[model samples]
Each structure stands twice: as structure tokens, then as C-alpha cells.
Target chain A: MKILVCISKTPDTTAKISFTDNDTKFNESGVQFIINPYDEWYALVRAIELKEKDPSTIIHLVHVGPAENDAIIRKALALGGDEAFRINSHPGDDYYVAGQIVNLAKEQHYDLIFTGKETIDYNGSSVGGMIAEFLELPYISLATKFELNGNTATITREIEGGEEVDEAALPIVVSCQKGMAEQRIPNMRGIMSARTKPLKAIEPVAIDPLTSISSFELPAPKQGVKMIPADNPEELVRLLHEEAKVF
Target chain B: MSVLVFLDQAEGHVKKSSFEAASFAAKIAEQTGTEANGIVLGEVKDDLQSLGKYGIKKIYHAADAQLNQFDDEIYTALIADTVKSSGSNVVVLSNNFNGKAIAPRLSVRLKSGLISGAVGLPDTSNGFKVKKSVFSGKAFANVEIKTDIKIITLNANAFKVTEGSGTATIENITTQIPRRKVNVREVNVVKGEVPLAEAELVVSGGRGLKGPENWGIVTDLAKALGAATACSRPVSDSGWRPHHEHVGQTGLTIAPNMYFAIGISGAIQHLAGVNRSKTIVVINKDPEAPFFKAADYGIVGDAFEVVPKITEAVKKLKGQK
Candidate 1:
């Protein structure tokens, strides 16, 4: 089985999020970058598990970004990916990025593709579905649990108030979230092997981005909390009504 | 061309998030000086006309029983055809489960620019610019869509539903359905539980609540406020709460009108999920609880005592037992 996992780099979860230059750009000055948690913990880990189950399964990690993202791609390889592919270009727009992935998926003819439900930074959650559409393949989003039985794949996804059990054949796409797999840390052996593993950087298919970032802005600072004594609980209710006017 | 809005439904009724999508589409229509129309892919039990108050001029419904269950492939094909036939330059959807699954596929099929989790209406003063949250609600990005056709999925609770005097006219439309590769084997419907996504208010607990046995305070407060119950990651990870009830960056992201944090210390991950809430109230015994920093109201007291008092006060205010 040929499985490809798409990964991205994001600011560490504990990093303080801020904007810069009149709030027109993300401030990366003091930020530490790591593999996006969803991609590392769910999508990549699940593919590694699948490869572990079948010795012949090949897991290739693919990323669409500039050379700066290669370190994160290598981290994915150290975690279990057999090789890595990096598109040498900046991620301009979601559509442009999806088109790049589609180009690679077509060339590779991967049997299965996995991506996090959404990137923590962009939070677009659009790539997997777009890739599926461009390839005319079956796609599932936010899958919590999954099982493979021969050519049939069973997925359990959380819906509004219930769970939906879905089944599809091989050659599918899945956007994974929590409960799909646990996080795995790279050991010394894996890191050493990753150093020798092939990391390929290729040119992107020339295409104009459908959208461009005009500017960025930070959310307004929240006001100070108004404290009402624990004894005066009704006053809190009154405040919610008159001051917050939420009710 | 008219703006096309996809109204999402669950079980048989329209979802509250879909109303927001409709309102957003209508506002865009008003801004662009065009009309807004609606489309329902599945059989709906709710009155589709009453949706006109949100400013939809007409609703084009495809009451196909086969579409009762979500098949994104079929949905994407159906919606793409609908957009083409309707001559819609822009398509709108709520950034909910189904919308998330289908919008991108539709965008790819139609070769249109798509923006997900849009927080504000477009700035059409120049070229079309839509503001959306990036970095998980930490910042906003104004994106200019260069594609002639655009698709936008509105963030849940970002746009308010407004009621107007006009009633919508329900128009029946027909389109070709595509083959489905995925088959839903079974659906386990959870009844009587408040859906955390559409809840206007939420009452969430954390490790400070002690254990699952001490969860009554959370539920009591939720019940008094008619809100859904949620929990932090640690509580869910430790088996004190169900995974679905976990609200954080990795869990479900909700933007309710009000979120009451009883015992959560407000980790950045937890705040990433619920920070979009309109109003937040925190009640933690510890004065240094991080949640207090983001809360609109703070009560530095024990949850054991403060929760019940607040519940009683809410019950009294609402005249509930």
C-alpha cells in the first residue's frame, strides 16, 4: 500500500500569538516552530501505524512550502515516514496549495492520503476535500476512528449529536483529528535513519493564487473582568442582563 | 447573478448555524445589490418559507430522500450543478461539519476561490476582500478573492441571524446526482443531549472540579442556563468526561454567545477553542487561574459553593424548579 501524509509547520502551542507591522503579518521573531500537532499526532501517526501493520506499506510525507519547512518534514521522517517531498515555494493560498498537492498525488498515484483536519495556523480545513475533488476520490473529514479490512475502510466520524459509521474502498482521502492515533516521539535510531533518508525538494506547478492576503489584524484586547462578590450571585445575573445584555 | 446559500440540516430540522449562513448570504446580497437564494439537498421537516425572514428571496430545494444522509461526493456534484444553473457568482455555506466536508470539494470542482471560517462580511469597496480568523482565532486576515466565482463558509456564530418581514418562496429544482463512493452503514443518533456546536451558551468544567462525580455543578449550571456542558482536555484525557464534550484546540471549537468556565485554568489550547465566544465568565477558587484573564466576569471562589449559588440564582430568575 502506498500512503502519503501531508504535514505543515506551526508555531508551538505554548507560544504567545501576536501580529506585527501594523498587524499585517504574523510575528515569528521569538516563536519556536514545530510540526502541527494534528498532522503529527493524528495524520502522520495513523499512517505509520498502517505501515507497521503491513511491512510492504510505504509511507511518504509530503509538504507544500518553502525550504524553511524542510526541517519539519525531516521531523516527520524521523517519526516514521519513509521519505519526504517538499514543494519549493511559499504557500500562497489554500487553492494554490491544494493544486500543488493534487499535482503530486497524480504523479505518485497514492492509494491513500491523510492530512490533519486543519492547520492550527490557517485553520482552513480545505485541502483534503479539495484534493479529493481534484482527484475524484472519496474523502472523509474529522474522522475520529478508522479501520482497514482488505480493500474496505470503515470510518467513524462524530456528527452533530451522534456518530456516523461510513465505509469506502481503497484509494481514498481522510482528514484526521484526535482519537485517530497517539503522538509518537522520534528515538535516536529513527533520528539517525532520518538523517540518511531521502528528502526531495521539487519545483511547484506555476499557478496564480486565487486569493491574496491584504492585511492582518489582532483581536481587540478583552476588558478587565468585573468581579461580583460570591454572596451577591443575583447581582451577577443582573449584570449579565443589563451590562452584558447577553440574555 | 444571485448569491447561493446552502442550508444545512440535521436529522430533519435546519441547523441554527445554517440560519447564520443564510443571514450572511443575504447581507452579501444586500451589499452587492443582488438577490439571495437558498438550497436544501435533503428532505427537511422544518418550514423552509419561514427562513425568508433571514432575507432569502427564494429557496431552491432538492427534496431527494437519498440525500437524507450526507454523501459529500454527491453533495458536491449537486451543489456545483445548482450553482451553474442558478447563475450564482458567489456560494455561501456555514462552516459546520457538512459544509467543511463539501465546500472545498465544490470549490475545486468549479475552480473557484474558497475561504473557510470567514468572520466578517466582505469589503467590496475595492476588489472583494473578506476578513477571516487565522492562527486559530488569534488574528484576522483580509483576503482578496481574485476568482470570478467565490465560495465562502461563514464561521459558526460569527454572523448573527436577523429577521425581516419578507417570506421566502420555495422553488423546486432538479439536477443530476453523482455516484457515491462512500456508504453510510449506520447512524447512531444521540437523543436529548444538547449539541455543543449550536448551543448559545456553554458551562464547562476542568480538573479543579475534582472528578466525574463532582460534575453535577457543571450540569446544574448548564441546566439553569439552558446551556450545553463542556470540559477541558485534562478532564477528557483522564476519562472524567467524554471526548466529544472536550472543548479545546484539538477538540470541538465553539463560539457560543456566552461561555462559563467553572474550574478551567485556561491553557492556550483550551482558550484557542472557546476564545471566539462573545462573553466569558470564570469562577475558579484560585485567584491566579489563567481563565480569569480572558473572562468578562470573574468570581474568585470555590466551584463547590459558587456554582450552586449561581444555579439557584438562575433558577430563581427564570422561575424554574
Candidate 2:
């Protein structure tokens, strides 16, 4: 089986989130970056699991980002993949990013493709379905369990209040979330060998972004909390009804 | 051009989120000097005409049985076809599971600018700008869609659904139903539990509650307040709660009207997912749990001691004896 995993970098979960450039761009100064958790811990790791079960399976990682992001792609290769491709461009928007991934997928004809549900930063959750639409392939979003059988894949995905078991043929795109796979850390040997993996940097296809952020705003800071003593828990209910008016 | 709203239904019933979407679409239609139309796929058992109370005057119904089982590609194509024929300049839906599945594909097909997690109405006084939460609700962004045909997916519970005396005329439309590549085998829906997505109030517990055996604090309060129950990552990971009930950075991100966090030290991972909640009430034994900083109300106490009393008070206030 041949698989392609989509990887991207996001601010570390603990990093302070702020906007710069008149509140249009994310402030990257001194902000640590890591492979998006959903991608690394679920999608990429799941692909590596497939290869581990079947050694003949080939896994390739694709990321659409500028040159600075290629380092993140290399780090992904350390987890487990045969090769990596970095589309040399800043991710303008969902359309452009999905279009670039389609450019690579069209050429490679990957039997399966994977992406995390969404990036922690933007949380668009758009690119994977867009790619599936561009390719006219089956898409299952928020999949919790995925198992491949001969020419068909059985999956269990989360819905509003339940789980739906589904089956789709090969050459499908899955937007993975938690419970899809366990997280893995790259060992010393894996990290050293990742340095020498074939990392190809290709130019991105020109595509115009359809939407742009006009300005960013932060939520109003919470005023000091009204603390109710443990001895007076009933007072909390009164405040919720009379003061907060939420319940 | 009419504003189109895709009425999301489940088990032949319309979801509350879809009504919220309809209300939102009506506002857009009013702003654009047009009217809002509704669309529904699959068979709906509800009185479709009564939905006009939410402001949609006309509805397009494609009651194909196959559509009851959602397939993103098929739904996208069907919605696209409706947009083309209905002369809709804007499409609206709830940014829930179905919305998240089909909105992006519909955007690609129609070449429309799409905003998935919209929290408020468009600011059309200037340009077509939509306000949405970013960074898992820690911040907000005003995004401008530069396309003539735009799509907005309102996040669940962001807009309230108000029913008036208006009645809609339901028009059954015929469209070619495409074959779905993904086939669903079994659907196991939990019966009678409040779905977390559309729930206005939620009661969540964390590892501080300890074992699954002591989960009564969450369930009792949730029952009394008529709220859904949720859990932190640790509780879910430890098998105390089902994965579907987990809410955190890697879990579900919810924006209910009110959230109660019990015995949880609000980590950024957990807080980011729920910071968008309208009001937060945190109950913990530790004095310095990070959740207090982000909470609207705080109680420095043990969950076992405080939760029962709060639940009793809520029940008493609601006249539940």
C-alpha cells in the first residue's frame, strides 16, 4: 500500500497566541513550533503503523509551506516515512494549500491520504475535504478507527451523539482526530536517519486565496472570578441564576 | 439572490443547530435585501412548513432516502446544484459534524469563500466580512470573503433560534442522486443524552474526580441543570468517560452558553477548547488551579463536597424537590 500523509506546523499548544502586523498575521517571534498534534500523533503515526504491519507499504509525507517549514517536514520523516515533499510556498489559505496537495497527489496517485482534523491555530478543518473534492474521492472526517482490508477500508467515525461504521474503497482521504492512533516519539536512531531521508522541495502551484483576515480581535479578558466558599456551595447556584443568568 | 440555509436533520428530525442556522440566514437575508430559503436532504418527519417561523419562507426538499446517510461528496454536489438553480448568493449551515463535512467541499465546487466557524453575522456595512473564533476560541478574526458566492457555517449555539408565527411553503424538488463512495454500515446513537454540540449548558469533570465510580457528581449536576456531560482528556483517556464525551484541545471544542468544570486543573490544552464558552464555572480543591484564572465563577472546594450541594440547590431552584 502507498500512503501520503499531510503534515504542517503549528504553535506549541502551550505557546502564547498573539497576532502581529496590525492583527492580520500570527506573531511568530519567539513562539515555538511543533508538528500539528493531530497530524503527528494520529495521521502520521497511523500511516507509520500501517507500514510497520506491512513492510512493503510505502509512506510519503507532504507539506505545503515556505522553506522555513521544511524543518518540520524533516522532523515528521523521523517518525516513519520513505520520503518527504515540501511544496515551497507559504500556506495562503485552505484552497491554495489543498490545491498544492492535490498537485502532488495527482502526480503520485497515492492509494490513501491522511490529514489531522485541523490545525490548532486556524482550526479551519477545510483543506482535507477540499482535497477530496478536487480529487473526487471518498472523505471521512473525524475518524476514530481505520482498518484497511483488501481494496476496502472499514472505518468508525464520530457523529453528533454516536459512532457510524463505514466502508470506503482505496484512494480515500481521511481527516483524523484523537483515538485514531497512539502518539510516537522519534528515537535517537530514527532522528539521525531522518537527517538523510530524501527531502524534495518543490515549487508550489500558483493559486489565489479566496479569503483574507481583515483584522483580529482578542476576547475580552475575564474580570476577577466571584469565589463562593466551599461551605456555601448553594450561594454559587444563586449567583448563577441571579447574577450570571446562565442556568 | 436568496440566502440558502441547509436544514440539518437527524433521524428524520431537524436539529436545533439547523434552526439556529436558519435564524442566522434570515438576518443575512434582511441585511442583503433578499429572502432566506431552506433546503433539506433525506426524509424529514417534522412539519417542514412550520420552520418558516425561524424566517425561511420557501424550502427546497430533496427527500432522497440515500441522503439520510451522509456522504460529503454527494451532499456537496447536491447543495451546489441547488445553489446554481436557486440563484443563491450566500449559503448557510451549522458548523457541526455535517457542516464540517460538506462545507469545504461545497466551497471548492462553487469556488466560493467559506467561513466554517462563524460566531456572528457578517459585517456587510463595509465589505463581506464574517467574525469567527480563531486559535480554538482564544482569539477572534474578521475574515473578508472576496467571492460573489460566499458560504457561512455558524457554530452551534452561537445564534439562538427564535420561532415566530410565519409558515413556510415547502417545495419538493427532484435532483439526480449520485452514488456515495463511502457506505455506512451501522449507526449507534446514544439514546436520550443531550448532545454536547447544541447543549446550552454543560457539566464537565476531570481527573480530580478520580475513578469512573465517582462520576455521579457530573451526571447529577448535569441532570439537575439539564446540561450535557463532558470530561477532560485524562478522564476520557483513563477510560472513565467515553471518547465522545471528551472536550479538550485534541478532543471536541465546544462553545456552550455555560460550562461547569469540576475537579479540573484547566491546562491550556483543555482551556483552549472551551474558552469560547459564554460563561465558565470552575470547582476545584486546589486554590491555584489554572482554570480559576479563566473562570467567571470559582469555588475552591472538593468536587465530592461541592457538586452535590450545587446540584441540590439547582434542583430546588427549578422546583424539582
Residue-by-residue lDDT tens digits, candidate 1, A1-247: 8999998889987778877887778889999999888889999999999988998999888898889788888888999988889989998887888889889899999989999999988889999998999999999888988899998999988778767899999899999988899878899999889988999999999978888888887788898888888777778888887788766
Per-residue lDDT of model 1, residues B196-275, tens digit only: 97788899999999999999989988988888899999999898988888988778888899999988999988998899
Q: Each model: TM-score of chain B?
A: 0.97, 0.97
CA-lDDT, candidates in order: 0.88, 0.91
TM-score attained by chain A of model 1: 0.96
Model 2 Cα shift for residue A208 (angstroms): 1.3
* Residue A115, model 1: Cα distance from true site in angstroms: 0.3
Q: Positional deviation of B89 in candidate 2, in angstroms?
A: 0.8
Task: Tell me how far the alpha carbon of residue A48 in candidate 2 is from the true structure, in angstroms, after superposition.
Answer: 0.5
Model 1: CA > 4 A from native: none
Report i-RMS for every model: 1.2, 1.0
